[model samples]
Target: MLIVITSEEFVEDEINIIKRLLKEGLTTLHVRKPFFSSEEMKRWLFNFHAEEHQQMMLHQHHFLAEDFQLKGIHLKEEHRKSIKGKEQDFLEKIKSQGWVLSTSFHELQEVENQTLFDYAFLSPVFTSISKHNYEGKKFSVQQNKRPVIALGGIKTENIEKAYQLGYQGVAVLGCVWHQENVITSFKNIKKEYKRVYQ
Candidate 1:
């Protein structure tokens, strides 16, 4: 199972926790700090000294990715639409730089329409602190072969349910961020996910 850690929810000790998770085998680390400025993010990346084990992805800032040499960039559905006509241009730029691109979708139709990204995130698969009223009743992966990550409200207990429902992996925030022991929480979640997926 792959774990994608968001930077927004885990502000304090973010770098430390991320480093720990990367060492423990996190598949991807998405630096999704929408509130922070590009300069601030660059500063954080420089100061944090993120290791090579965790592939880093910036959110909605393709320019910064180019400047900082990040592995990839993630765009929201709205952002994706705004760049619709320029999809090829954007894809070419990302490809030229050898960067992976991903986007988030709220519906299956959107997922079906999106072909430019390497993966797509379908969120709120289960009720989560980051989101509410997500009972997994409306979430479905459909027939899309592209990797789709089930985000929002995913925990150690419900990860198996997510994978069973056809998600390539699960993205999380509060589940690990809110824990007093981030390392233990990540390790346990990773262990549980491996057991279920294996």
Candidate 2:
């Protein structure tokens, strides 16, 4: 249950690094480029083998899920609110297609109350590595009802703490992408997560 989230901005050799990460056994990838148009995203995705599609999740252009058969679709916190009235039907459709459903949560209580998503992300368990001045809550999910993955500032050093705090998994952004050697960074995080969980 380790996941890698794409940097919001493009990184050099990103596609190749991602392919390498997948080959290195990355459990999942959350494609969260908010600015990418459907065409751009499609063209980018075209680089992967069809089998790699199952390891990917989309944060936008969910309609592409039908075309690419992605593993899941993520609802941004705002998008979740915008679709309030129609969320059930929307989620049911994705579920019917056998895709995993996930969304972001800023509060631990929000995750506990959630019943629609297969899993939810709880962020800032440590001060964000990618966003300046965004503080960490160090949220504890001991009472959560479903899987809650820790996001924000996750890296090899603190994976055990996240697990001990009751997170089912961790989602990484800056810890991997900000590194000079992305693959080594990712492998270290994954190894730490496995040591703590498996």
How would you encode candidate 1's per-residue C-alpha lDDT over 36-69 as one tens digit per residue? 7777777777754435422788785568777667
C-alpha lDDT of all candidate models, in order: 0.76, 0.91
Q: Residue 144 in model 2: shift from native, Å?
A: 0.5
**Candidate 2 per-residue C-alpha lDDT over 67-149 given as tens digits, one digit per residue, 9 for 90 to 100:** 99889899888888888999788877887899998999888778889988989999889899999998899999988879999
Give the winner by TM-score. 2
lDDT of 2 at 81: 88
Worst 10 residues of 2 by lDDT: 87-96
lDDT of 1 at 105: 81
TM-scores for every predicted model: 0.90, 0.97
